[model samples]
Target: MLPLVHNELYVEFNDEKQGPFYPAEGPIPFGKFRKHKKSSVELKADRIGELAKTISLPRSALSGINGSDQALLAQANIVQMEKPKSMPFDDSPFLQSTTFKNKLDAKTAIADYLGKPLSRLTDLQIVAINMILDETLDKKTVMDKIRAYFTLSSAGHSGGD
Candidate 1:
């Protein structure tokens, strides 16, 4: 039977109706559900993809690895990419010592378009705003870029434009 309020399809199992099932999906594990987690190899593959984006790895080197776990580990070791030192809640020492606030304040047009005082913006927001604030870009362009940035960020995309 079609759900009236929620358009989810229900499965009829053993003369009983099971709901909230979608096409192309398996039966819900219900109480037996263990949260799906990526295995270590999958995690390492993800890390390799991320690191490859940041650093210029030779095609030959990547191909030579042939998806071996040891090779992937060796490549990761070669890059030496350390994770960021702190969480979002913790203040960044670099931002703390830098003059981004003063720079943002000095630009009245950019500040006005943002619709917030420098003090009101978070460090990440300030960084995004600063990154796109080229003298060539108008206030609307700047704001649009910043909007797109936050949208991508909220959608879980990371790294530069």
Candidate 2:
């Protein structure tokens, strides 16, 4: 519900999936807005696809509750509203793994094939090398893919090997 304008109560409508829309321009009175779907909360996976209910308590609703209970309820509501934070990117797992060694070997091989230092390789060249290396880092496989990429890049075609 929005603030009263000239003693008339106003309310806003918002659809979770489509977001809020202004019908007849801005907030309408509760009676003026048509109700659909009856307003239900749906629990879904992290990805979008269902309606999520927002837990909000108006000041009047919380006024009657005892301080301790109100604090607990507020904490619980906050927990429900917050999304879990993800761990930042880290390479510790591959620091000394065989996959790490293979990646290094692949990078070196690509640099050698292109007759350039690894740091001197362009972003596109590095990405092309990594794309092939991701499939299989065998020397022959890497060489063949790099050759294909080189051919395409030289032929005025790009982005695909």
- Best candidate, lDDT-wise? 2
Cα distance off (Å), candidate 1, residue 70: 99
Q: Which stretches of candidate 2 lie over 4 Å from their true place?
A: 1-101, 157-161
Q: Estimate the overall C-alpha local distance difference test score of candidate 2.
A: 0.65
Model 2, residue 103: what's the lDDT?
81
Global lDDT of each candidate: 0.64, 0.65
Candidate 1, residue 81: CA error in Å?
84
- Writing each residue's lDDT as its tens digit, candidate 2 over 1-161 gives 86655443345557335424345456566778665533344323422343234455767565665667758888888533456798998888766443325788778767777887867666887787778888886766667778888877779865543
TM-score of each: 0.25, 0.33
Q: Model 1 Cα displacement at 72 (Å)?
A: 99
Q: Give me the runs in candidate 1 sitting further than 4 Å from their true place.
A: 1-107, 151-161
Clashes of 2: 0
